[model samples]
Target: MTRKIIAMAATVICVLGGFTASASSVAQDNPTVKEVKLRAEFYQNELDLLLDKARRGNFADFYQDVVKFAHYGEKYPQYLLGVMLLKGDGVQQDIGQGLVWIRLALEQKNTEWQKVYDSITAKLTKEQLDALEPMYETYKARFGVQAQKMSCNNEKMEASNIRIHQCRKTLVLKEFYSVYEYN
Candidate 1:
């Protein structure tokens, strides 16, 4: 299972090269449905892998997968990671950490993700709530930077395209941005 997750993640990296948008683009702004679809096409397989792992209580690999997925702006794994941490499934049970992960998932623009955050909020204590705020601020800053790592504008890309790729690269990301902004 671990091998499968690693392999799928590697596949995502390979296919990401062909995506029209860069992760950096998504990081700078909200991802369009098209950009999200492009990413989902690349990510779904891996997401399935992680979901299976989480379902079976495979915490260690699931945790690693969640970290990788979090870097990609995926909220599903973040939600699952919250569950795992809350239950101490693979990692130590830590509600504070779980809430932080859930909040991060909710911030990523998924209404479904927000449901999990709301459910958590309904159950937390004042102490947990207190711990969650500062942790959320820290996560927001870090997530903003890491969210773009899932896009295609990393070291693998040609240096020449770095500045100009957003324009010349497939209308995928820019097109996504242009179209997405309207909605």
Candidate 2:
């Protein structure tokens, strides 16, 4: 279970795109190490919550919650919504709109999100790209992090001795981490 959690945490950090330090830069006393540690703690809190809820098994409710959180400017949810839109899973199929959500989600770039963005964009024709450009620009202006004035804060969890970081665009709320989450 601990190994599973660490692997999941590593993936979350990669997608979160919060670290740029190379392996050589990580050390026992380095700031990068501290940052990574804090991020792990934050993601672990998310994982614990999400894993528990997922065990209850109501995907429709889960999908709705993801949509809500995406609109709320949480990065991971935005990425999930993008994939959901593209796949027409629990929502209408709309590749163009899906790509838009994904582009917005990549505010903090990582190879994982970049690969998804590139794969989708590569499949688009000139006309499709042209058509989607305006919509993407509009969504970027409206829902982008700068537009939302979204900012993250590290708050101590009342139930535990650790702190969790949450980003708020407008209203603040609690939010998740786990491999089972992706599954």
Candidate 3:
């Protein structure tokens, strides 16, 4: 009886260990790193276009880019879309939706988003800001969690231009000139 009990225990341990190893191997094979890298690359491309439109003061082009990329569910694109709406840059002004995206961006901890937020907020009256408070609170309650806050101050226009140039270089290296192929 003692020998039977020891054999049963050993069999259970071996089965569990095998299961765990298999599970770990499967997870390793399906690594999320490639998906994440692709998303980052896509985002960088969109950001490059946005920076170009912004530098040229072509809000219409910028607005189109915002709508096109916002479909990807990327936080930065959403934030920029909100900024465009809030400032009436390329679309009909809608403060409520704009604030929603701003809050979402904040929740995502995209610090660079703060620059667009600040720019729009500076244009709004105190009454407007007050009106947005409740909506902001609701959004916060739903999705707000502590995230690393990002700052936009001391970010010079020159720095953004440099980034644009770098992005262009990357695109050239990748053999992609236009984000939208003129076919």
Candidate 4:
């Protein structure tokens, strides 16, 4: 009786395995599945080619490919291309354009890339800094007055009649006069 039960169980298991294998084969023949598999294959092929170029230190080829990938508006590719440009590893050194791309990457709010963005910004020029003024103004205008206000508040204790906020974000005050005194 035990041998009969074991044989029955083996038969059931084989039947279930055969059904699963046939079902998977049918699914694989579905047009949608075929299309998805084809697209995945193409994507992987392109990725592999790009990685191979990068590994070979063929930066110019990799850079151009990256630009093409970036033009597709892929955020990670844009960030990588910007980093390459900033470092002058492959493409021409264009800090301004690199900052633009890095800013675009940051605008996606990808916190993972924030360190790269910050590192690139640290090496930016005065001109690049000036160029971001419009972006700051736009953000302030869109986000409201509170966003524009410097992020500092201090209790006043006057030393020699001057009240200092000591905020790092504040512009250097060329001249300071109270509103009442100025008026």
**TM-score quality measure for candidate 1:** 0.49
Regarding TM-score, does 2 or 3 come out ahead? 2
lDDT of the candidates, in the order given: 0.51, 0.54, 0.46, 0.45
TM-score of 4: 0.42
Give lDDT tens digits, candidate 3, residues 107-178.
Answer: 454445555455545554576566666655543333233111122222224636432111011233354322
Q: TM-scores across all candidates? A: 0.49, 0.52, 0.39, 0.42
Off by over 4 Å in 3: 1-46, 110-183
How much is 110 displaced in model 3, in angstroms? 4.4
lDDT digits (tens) for residues 29-131 of candidate 2:
2122110112335554664465455456343457776664555456767776776666556676555566777887887554577677776566555665676
lDDT for predicted candidate 2 compared with the true structure: 0.54
Worst 10 residues of 1 by lDDT: 174-183
Quote the lDDT for 95 in model 4.
44
**In model 2, which range of ten residues has the least summed lDDT?**
29-38
Better structure of 1 and 3 per TM-score: 1
Report the lDDT tens digits of candidate 4 across residue range 1-183. 223323442343344332111122112221221101114345446756876776676677677777654443344556676666555666765444554566654544555466655644454456556765554333223222232122344435566664533221222243321110000
As a whole number from 0 to 100, the lDDT of residue 13 in candidate 4 is 31
* Error in Å for residue 124 of model 1: 3.9
Tell how far residue 41 is off in model 2, in angstroms. Answer: 15
- Clash count, one per candidate: 1, 3, 0, 0
Q: Which stretches of candidate 1 lie over 4 Å from their true place?
A: 1-44, 55-57, 108-116, 123-127, 144-183
